[model samples]
Target: MKIYDWFDGPYPARVRIALAEKGLLSRIEFVPVNLWTGEHKKPAFLAINYSGTLPVLELDDGTLIAECTAITQYLDVLDGNPLLTGRTPAEKGIIHMMTKRAEIEFLDAVSTYFHHATPGLGPDVELYQNREWGERMRDKAVRGMHYFNGVLANRPFVAGNEFSMADIAVLGGMIFASLVKLPVPDECEALRAWHARMLERSSVQEWRAMVERGQGVKTLPITADLK
Candidate 1:
C-alpha cells in the first residue's frame, strides 16, 4: 500500500508522530508539500484536498483521506494497533469526543496565535495574513484552556484513563504553543503531567527532535526529550 503524505506544520506533524509510532514512517512516500510556499493551495494540491490543507493522505487504492481525526482513525486501523484508537465501541465514542474537544480547544488556539502573533508564522508574511487574527485565536484558546483545565483536573487522560488520539491531537498543538511562548497554565496540573508522560513516548521524542531541528516552531519554552 502507498501513502502520499503532505506535511510541514504542526497538524501534519501529529500524523507523522502517529505514523512513526506505528512503524509506518519508512513504509510510505514522503511528499513534502511546502505550506510556506502556498503549495497546498495550488490547483494540483487542491484537487486532492479542496480545503487546501496539508497532511492529506492518499491511500493505495486512490482514496483521499482528509482531516486529522479521520486520517488518524484510518492509520490506526490499518496499523492493527487497535489500542491507538480504542478497543471497544464505547472507547471509540469517548475517544472521538475528546479528540474533537482537543481540536477545537488547543489546536484552534495554536493555529490562531501562530498565524496572528508570530512573524512569518503562516505561508506568507505580507499577503494572506491577518494582523489581529492571532489575538482573537489566543483569546479563544485562553478560554478553552480554562475549560480544559476543569475537565482535565480530575482525569488521567482526555477520555478517562486510556490514552487516546485526543491526547495526541491536543499535545501536538500544546507542544507548539509551548514552542511559541504560549505557556500551558500551571493550574492545569493534570494536563502538564500528561504532557510530561507524552514526552516520554518514542514517537513524540522523535518528532520533537525533528520539529526543533527544522525551523518549524518559533520557540521552545521547555525542551521536551530530544531523543
Candidate 2:
C-alpha cells in the first residue's frame, strides 16, 4: 500500500497515527504530496483523488481510498480487529458521531481559519480568502475546544471509555490548532489533560518523530506518473 500525504499535516497525522496503532506502518510506503507547493491541487494528483486531499491510500491492486475516516476504517478492519473504529454497532455509531462532531466543530474550523485568516499554503494555493469568515471559524474552533473540554470532563475518551476514531479526530483538531497558533484556552483543564495523555501514546510519539525527521526534507515533485 502507498499513502500519498504530506508529513506533519494534521489530517495526515490522523491516518499515520492510526496506521501506527494498527502496527501496519512497516507494510506501507509513504508518498509525499507537497502541501506548500499546491501539489495536491494540481491535475496529476487530482486524477488519483478527485477531492485532492492528502493521506490517500492506494491499494496494491490499484484501488484508491481517499478521506481519513474511510482510510482508517479500511485499515482498522484489515486485521479483523477494528480497534480504532469499533466492533459493536453501538460503538460504531457513537464513534462516528463524535468523530464528525470533532471535524465540524474543531478541525475543519481551524482549517478554514488557516486558509482564510492566515497565509496558508501561501498566495499560490489560496486563491480566495475571506478574513471575516475565517475569523468566525476561528472563534468557532475555540468554542469547540470548550465544548470538547466539557465532554472530556466526564469521559476518559471522546466517544466513551476507550480511545476510538473519535479521539483521533479531536487529536487532529488539536494538531491543526497548534499549527495555526490557536491556543487551547487555559480554562479548559480537562481538554489539556486529555491532550497530554494523548501525546504520551506510542502512536502519537512515533508520528511526532516522523514529523521531526521530515522537517527540512525536500518533497517529491508532482508528476504525471505519481502512481
List lDDT for all candidates, in order. 0.70, 0.92
lDDT of 1: 0.70
lDDT of candidate 2 vs native? 0.92
Model 1: how far is 216 from its true place, Å?
A: 13
Off by over 4 Å in 1: 1-8, 120-133, 212-227
lDDT score for residue 209 of model 1: 74
Tens digit of per-residue lDDT, candidate 1, span 1-227:
33333334778778878777777766666556666666666666677677877676767677878887888888888846665678889999898888888878778777867776776535453356665887888877767777767777888777878777887888777766876778877787767777788889898887777666753222221112211
Runs in model 2 with CA error above 4 Å? 215-222
Worst window of 10 by summed lDDT in candidate 2: 215-224
> At residue 104, what lDDT does model 1 achieve?
81
